[model samples]
Target: MDTLALKILFMVGFIAAWAIRTPYQKRDKQTKRLAARLVLRERVLFVLIYVGMVILPLIYVFSPWLSPADYHSSLWAGYLGAIFFAISLWLLWRSHHDLGRNWSPTLEIREGHTFVSSGIYQKIRHPMYAAFWLWCVAQALLLPNWVAGLAGMISFGIMYVLRISNEEQMMLQHFGEEYKAYMQRTKRLIPYLF
Candidate 1:
């Protein structure tokens, strides 16, 4: 497939992902938070993620600025990317659905938050993160531009490395032994594997 077609395909998937998250994002705003840790460092990381996952990808799709970094990928790779993108969307939706009002954009424990160990969470402690990893994979395969394509992984990887320990610690503090046992049994992302 041509680059233009591939870009268009990516936009469709992106828009669908956005639509899936819209309701959940809005719902999260109304739910009262019991605690939150939106520190400056966390805010900066989020900004980086926004630039990488949203701004850079948009620039690559809509402008010629990233054309110089474009590379050819096999047709099969593009098809595989579409598949990965679809799976990411599914996992994203499922993660939000299973978490319900327990979900928050930042490190937060909502009022009445319960330890969720069902649905996708039954096997993976962070299915949402796994979905995002798949998203980055899809982005890399679909964009065909070195800087734009890899930006999501580079940015999110940094944030994941810096934030996951803190996130798990917060969970341990809140849920105590329950979360610790969950962690012992479940992988962070993959099912029975990491």
Candidate 2:
């Protein structure tokens, strides 16, 4: 298959994976108290990520403005991108499964939220973030357009750097020593090394 096909497949698969969790998240949201919400900085990052990963990529795929010049990469790169995308999707699914009702689109403590340290969560505190990184890498590999391909990394990388400490602080405040112990045990986005 060609680069455009690979890009479309990756993006579609990414959307489908996230869409699968929408209902569950909505159901959880009904009961969630929203102890905290994203501040202006985080909200900015959220918009950036959404636009970079979804809007820009779609434009690049379907329109000529974004993808001005066609760059060539080997078929092996496409296969590698597909593999990364697949892994990302799996990580997303598993992270959602582990977090369940505790999951929120933004930074917020859910009502009756429990500190999860099982399954994939046992190894990494933020598997979802890792999945996102994978998605970014996949996008870079699958899409040849510089604007679309690198946007995910640039947008999401900013968010990750700004938000991770705040997220950990929020969790630490909510869970206290329990979360501290969990943090001591597991890495943030990688296992054994961070």
Per lDDT, the best of the predicted structures is 1
Local distance difference test, candidate 2: 0.85
Off by over 4 Å in 2: none
Cα deviation at 126, candidate 2, in Å, is 0.4
23-88, model 2: which lDDT tens digit per residue? 777787587575875667767888999998888888887778875655777888788888888899
Which parts of model 1 are misplaced by more than 4 Å? Answer: none
Q: List the candidates' TM-scores in order.
A: 0.97, 0.93
Which whole-number lDDT from 0 to 100 does residue 137 have in model 1? 94
Full-model lDDT for every candidate: 0.92, 0.85
TM-score of 2: 0.93
What TM-score quantifies how close candidate 1 is to the native fold?
A: 0.97
